[model samples]
Target: MEESTNIDQCTMEQKEPRKVTKRKFRYIGDFQVSDLECPKKRRLYWNPTQKFMSSSRRKYVTLKTKIHRLKNRINYLSTLLTELTECDRKFPVPRSIDFNKQFVTVELIQGQFVPDLMNLIIRFADSSK
Candidate 1:
């Protein structure tokens, strides 16, 4: 009877499922910019990490920086145009003016630099038009 009872207990233990210990894995160290492969996935991960900041915020910051750069470029171009106009008025090339009257008159008013810059501007304007 004791042998039969031991066998029954063994069978019961075998029939029952074993308990599994669950584990959560966490990453350490800084998140690299190269790690973000997918833009859609970037929106999903909500961990408040200093390394991997929110995508929307990063985009906003980048856009602001680009706008600032564009504004600076605009100011630079305006000043450059005004300076060029002054140079053109100071030194007149009557022949070129009559020949290309329709185009914006960029002339060689000073040293080698002015001619090079004027040529590039002329080429760019011609291509754009």
Candidate 2:
């Protein structure tokens, strides 16, 4: 389970396709991470959104392997949310952010995400652009 191991040990965080693909996706094209073009390789078994992410509770995940899945899932949701919301400077800005990194440092917010706040983020992102 190298994929699982990579998620935990890797310094950066991002979502991974459930299956592998030989096609290479560039950083800034139709298949770019920002575009978040859905993978055509594997049928998307789950459409777990940020709302679902908030509900995810993986207790008893003592093994590093167990935690990897949870962390990677969250990172993917964070990226998607950022894209959908069109966040401005609100997006994570990890000091060493690179293509090889596994995790992004998204701003940590406590409590439920207010719809109003989401709207605000959208407006902010729009204005910045």
Candidate 3:
């Protein structure tokens, strides 16, 4: 009887699903900004860049690239926040907006924000108008 019980316990253990660990995503170093440029319209524009260690590739990469305008800073941030929330619902996307400098920063994940995803979001946003 004891041998039968042990065999059942072993079978139950083997039937249990194994837990898979996910690789952590983290940012490396400090955020850097490109030189601000003033166009003929006298509007200030700049690009904010940050290096992040890709969770899958395990290498440093430039993940953020967006030109920010000083005039429409608030609108830009709001639009990005709304679009991101509507498009990606799986992982929590964290974003920081610098009103003084007129730039936005976002924590990115590999395979999360591909060009196609961004294009789709942009098109969706535009179509709603």
Candidate 4:
């Protein structure tokens, strides 16, 4: 009976072969590197373990962030400009405020102000006319 069981097991093993399943790697986009001479090196290069952002995707994200930041800055500046205009109206300047010609005079005022900010303000004021 043991001999018969052993023979049965041998036959069963011969009848069915174990199926070896290869790992299916998913690559980003249609581009794939399969020209490598070594299979092991190819597998390592195509390994999904390492996450990488494509250059176009990185640029898109950077542009999106910049646009959002600029939009917020524009909104803030708009509100600030309106408030400043209202305040200026309420408290009239003793002297005529001329943005076009008074840049030199404004720069002479004793206060901590960025030159770039002053330039931008002057440009904005000039463009509004």
Best-fitting candidate, scored by lDDT:
4
Looking at model 2, how many pairs of residues clash? 5
Question: Candidate 1 on 2-107: residue-level lDDT in tens?
Answer: 9999999999989988789743212324334554676643433335353355666898899999999999999998887667668946644333346553333434
Q: On residues 79-110, what C-alpha lDDT tens digit does candidate 2 reach at each position?
A: 88768566766766444546433222222243
TM-score against native, each model: 0.31, 0.20, 0.18, 0.31
lDDT of 3: 0.51
Please give the TM-score that candidate 3 achieves against the real structure. 0.18
What pairs collide in candidate 3?
none
User: Comparing 2 and 3 by lDDT, which wins?
Assistant: 2
Give model 3 RMSD, 1 decimal: 31.5
Better of 1 and 3 by TM-score: 1
lDDT (C-alpha) at residue 8 in model 4 = 95
Q: So what's the TM-score on candidate 2?
A: 0.20
lDDT of each: 0.63, 0.54, 0.51, 0.70
Residues 1-129, model 4: lDDT tens digits: 999999999998898877999645555543355535677756555654344446567889999999999999999988876676689467442466788557755665745346766899999999999
Please tell me which model should have the higher TM-score, number 1 or number 2. 1
